[model samples]
Target chain A: MLNKHPALLKKTLSAFAVLIFWIAVWYAAAAIVGYELILPSPLNVIISFGGLIRGGEIFAAVGASLLRVMIGYIAGVAAGVITALLTDRSAVLRQILAPMLTVIKSTPVASFIMLAWMFVGNEKLPILVSFMMVLPIIWQNTEAGLSAMDKELSEVAEIYELKFAKKLRIFIIPSLLSFVIPALITSMGLAWKAGIAAEVISHCKNSIGNGIYESKTYLETPELFAWTAIVIVLSLIIEWLLKLLGRRLMKFERI
Target chain B: MNEYNIKAQNITKRFGSEIVIDNFTCDFMPDTLYSINGASGRGKTTLLRILAGLDRNFSGILDIRGKCSVMFQEHRLFPSLSAVDNILELSFEKKDPALTDMTMSTLSSLGFSPEDMKKYPDELSGGMKQRISFARALLFKSDILILDEPFKELDENLRSVISDIILGESKHRTVIVSTHEIPEIFKNSAINIQL
Candidate 1:
């Protein structure tokens, strides 16, 4: 895997050097602060992560948060794809959705969380917020893909008088992959952050957001840092998986 | 004796205020060969696309009577699909035995090997890419086969072979060939139209 890309080795070395430099800076900052309450060091966070893991409570929180994110993500992808396809076929629908999606995208996550908290149950608030986060990104990217589709494909379809399902499977999906894969990879992280933010506001019984909130409320600075670090790690892992899937989807474009 | 015919009447095309084809009229008889030869920007490709039912932006009464297969000027093969996939995909039937066999034979007839069939368009040379597009056009086995500059990048030997094949295919089907190298396709054409 080290030699998978042309500059993979060089990139890996540079990335590691940057990581070490940041860790040293963090260590120095913690030494200067001399108080865990204000700025917990990287080592303290790691140790706190291990202690949380040993109690098995972190697993429940992670599982609950993961379930919420997955559900919201899948639903958002479905709705976004359908909406994009609808808009692509009709100028009216495109006009209607343009301002609506702009409003959704422009509004702050905190505002959306507040609205969902007022309307939705605490358990579903995270899902709603994550869904909101992923919708416009996927829709816009997919719409762009459909707009720039190869004209030859439609000509071929009309020449053959191909059925709708056949055209979708052969031409549409494959063409959309060039756009959809990257959007999916990007939105995974966005959805995770949005969902966690909603959970912090909603006060779900067993979730990472709840743990972070409790830590803050009780003045457990190390635990707060530990939860934040877990969120970052999970986000990275999910993004990595999405990128791997993107590579697999784009295998056809490679020789 | 023509069972099927394609007729165009007083066709006019314009891009903005600049007219491309002005007041053109023609008739393409069935079971015959036609060659459309013109200089660059004379709208030969545009005319072919109109006749094949691919372009409708032009103001024309073009009657394409039967199923038509077209090889565009720029070898518009799908960049994401392999050679065989590009030919066989976008069809109603995904796995028809007869269609698959015909596609394989057409690719082979066009000098494409099995290994070449698995390669993507970017992996192919310009000549190979055009050959694949030609093979895909033939795989349709339509009543009207429209080739636009089909032999521009091909070598002499392959050109003769493909020319002979087109000539043989034209005997029983309506073939419309448009090219800059008129002599390659002109030898067997029954009606030659110069725009």
Candidate 2:
């Protein structure tokens, strides 16, 4: 029942209205500043966006960065879910992983990026950084989901003599997905931000971070703004797609 | 003579410090629709759990029981799955040879139409969800049926629907139903056990 989509045209119109309001504020700020270099106006950024799109390099950069983030995201989700499952089964295993999870959660992303750059080098730096950023979130959410399982349900399975595989398929996975789906979608945005940051620091070729670096180095403020806008839009789009995927996976519940 | 017997010998259970079931003993005979009737918190559910081998920490023994399937006090339907899917899941796990027909027949006997099967627990009324939970318990392969407050939150008509199903199904099986009230329909057929 909750799966019903909101009114599409209404949502779109409201989104545009907000965008326009923000653009007006940005234009005013840019005018007061009296320099494109300090804060590019909305029009300058739009023009820069047009110029960047025409070059065709933006596509390659987006593609390269997206691929890296995706790889890292998948790795994180798999590792997190599996680890959570194992730890949930045994208190000993949970005790062992507790400190490690804490460290992963508390440490800064920049530090991880620098460490990853040293170890995995330029090409794999974003992938590692994104992986680090995503791992604890997915793990914690999966743990939450698994731990929230109804003990009564497990007793039901026991009396019914449900096999391990059947219990996992019927009750465990669905319960886990309910918790993990939101975390998965949230981690996508986190992954993109961390991945792009790593790319910028590592100066990877043919990546969004490299594009940002080039734009800023040559004093192309509008181009930098354009790249930032692209990052924001892509993150939103990817998050929406993941939500659709979540709905499909939970189609039985109608979301 | 009883066709089969489950002898409960001095069964006792305690929750923390309070003794809910204190050294109770009884024999559960087969081919009978039995109701454990008591007021709330009289350990009726607790005794059923013990009899169903769900509460093994009890002091006494409930011997000579075939496989037991239980309907819990709560609905316990998977909120994520539709009514049909919830029933079919356990049936599939049991590897029932005639899965579709078995599911359809059992649900139909419980007064569920084909269309109602596709709706999830949230979509169904409380009574309908209770009926679905009842169907899930009934579908499992077991000779001994244990129902804990099975008629809860249901209308008299729905209760009659369930009563009729139990009356028909319990003729050849040992059915233990726990409830606060034994419905008018079951008075003639059901053996009342006060807990």
Candidate 3:
């Protein structure tokens, strides 16, 4: 088994070595600074993380943040796919939605959060912000996937007279997944980050963003680092899950 | 029922300023084999595409009586599917055991091992992919079979074997094949249309 996956093993070991190197540098830097408020060591952050976990507030914060981000991510992905199909089929719709999506893509997330705060409550602002951040990315990637479809395979479908549902199952969905999966994995990190940022700005209750904000306001540098570590770990886990899902879907196509 | 399976009249195809096929006329009957012989860029693929209803940009009078199954010049197998699944996806009786058996037998005849049937298109060689494409066209239930350069990637022995299979399958349908030159086996039986 080790021989079969030597490359994957090597990659993991390399990543671990790089992480160790960075942590060592950070430890040295913290020692040189000689002040915990300025730069907390890795051990200081771990102790702070343990305190939060023991207080049971971290669970609630993590759960609330995850729920907000998941709601926005699911809705954004669904809307993106539907709109891409509509624009791909109709030139008029494409013309109408193109400029609007372009503007959304170019606009700053912070500005959108500030604007959304006016219309939405503190808890809901994060959902809207994450949705806005994810929509254009999924849309652009899905559109590119549709445009890059093999024309020859479409001609084969035409010649074979495949039914609409069959064509979608055998050709369209499989082809689109190649592009859509990467977009989904990429957008997941963006959605999580944007959702947390909106929470921090809006002062959403019972969220990791709230925890981070409180830590920063209280001058608890170690706690701030702990919250940031949680964010990074969650993003990596979500991306890894998305990749596994993509692999399973592609495996279904092969069968 | 129409006497002619396909009747194309005064078909003129042009790409921008260059003319490919100009005022070409042909009448194809059912249960006959036709070899469309031409050099590269002589519009054999274009004319076949037109007849198969894949290209509608040409000015022509075309009437096709039945469904068409095409083997494209390139092996257009789905990259995600195994060799057997690629052919099975196009079968009308996909759930039937006989269909699966027939697919396996056809693949076996075309030089595919049991292991080869489970391998995806990317894992297969160029000649193997071409044979899978040919198997798909042969197995699909259609009255008209349009094959564009079907034997272009095969060895001489495989070509002769594939030619025999094509001839054997042409007893009930109209088979139109495009090639640089007519194979020796098809020279006596196939109507050669030179462009």
Which portions of model 1 show Cα errors greater than 4 Å? A1-17, B1-3, B90-92, B96-98, B184-189
For candidate 3, lDDT tens digit of each residue in B141-175?
98898888988889988898899988987888999
| Superior by TM-score: candidate 1 or candidate 3 | 1
Candidate 3 docks at the CAPRI level of acceptable
Task: Give the clashing pairs for model 3.
Answer: none
* Model 2, position A236: C-alpha lDDT score: 88
lDDT of 1 by residue, B1-195 (tens): 555567888889898999888887987776778888888888899888888877788886887777888887788777767888888874325768788788878778778889998888888989988988787776675788888888788888889888877787787678888876676446555578888
DockQ of each: 0.43, 0.44, 0.45
lDDT of 2 by residue, A1-255 (tens): 223655876787798999899989999999999999989999999999999999999999999999999999999999998888899889999999999989888888888888778889999999988888788899999999988988888887787787888788878887788899999998899999999999999999999999999999999999999999999999989999999999999875443
**Per-prediction fnat:** 0.43, 0.54, 0.61
- B161-188: candidate 2 lDDT, tens digit per residue: 8888888778867899998987887787
Query: Alpha-carbon error at B193 in model 3, in Å?
Result: 1.9
Q: Which regions in candidate 3 have their CA more than 4 angstroms from the true location?
A: A1-38, A243-255, B155-157
Q: Estimate the overall C-alpha local distance difference test score of candidate 1.
A: 0.84
Clashes of each: 0, 0, 0
Q: Which ten residues in a row have the lowest lDDT in candidate 2 chain B?
A: B88-97
List TM-scores for all candidates, in order: 0.91, 0.86, 0.89
- Candidate 3 lDDT for residue A173: 92
